[model samples]
Target: MTTTTDSPRWFKSSYSNNGGNCIEVAANIPGAVPVRDSKNPHGPALVFPADEWSSFVSAVRAGEFGNL
Candidate 1:
């Protein structure tokens, strides 16, 4: 079996405007989620375990971060 590492397909939320502080996330990668600054596509990306990323997203959706 041949395994290939695909490139990250980063995207920010539709609600995001031209704000330079935005972050982009790539959910396409299996087992991992890559996050990076939307303003710097070519910059380094931080990879997080899929489960952890999922939990973080869920918390955000549930407003656990409190108006972030």
Candidate 2:
């Protein structure tokens, strides 16, 4: 696991309407993207490689998941 001394700057999409099933992502971290539940800010975060995260976001934006 990658560890960093810097704190994560969490961000949630504006499209989220306070829905209970929303996730917050921290893009400020270098080389990694940390994601956690918006409802549970104190909970554990799942970190992914920055490149992988970018690809996943691109796929979502391109509707690869279909009606997600």
Highest-lDDT candidate: 2
Q: Give all candidate RMSDs, comma-separated.
A: 2.2, 3.4
Instruction: Count residue pairs with overlapping backbones in model 1.
Output: 0
Q: What is the lDDT of residue 15 in candidate 1?
A: 79
What local lDDT score does residue 31 receive in model 2, on the 0 to 100 scale? 91
Candidate 2 Cα deviation (angstroms), residue 55: 0.3
The digit string of per-residue lDDT tens for model 2 on 1-68 reads 55472578898998998868999999888899999999999989999999999999999999999999
- Give per-residue CA lDDT, model 1, range 1-68, as digits (tens): 33223566778988788778899998788888888988888888889999999999999999999998
The number of clashing residue pairs in each candidate reads: 0, 0
Q: lDDT scores for all predictions?
A: 0.84, 0.89
TM-score for predicted model 1 compared with the true structure: 0.84
Best by TM-score: 2
Clashes in model 1: which pairs? none
- Superposition-based RMSD of candidate 1 using all C-alpha atoms, in angstroms: 2.2
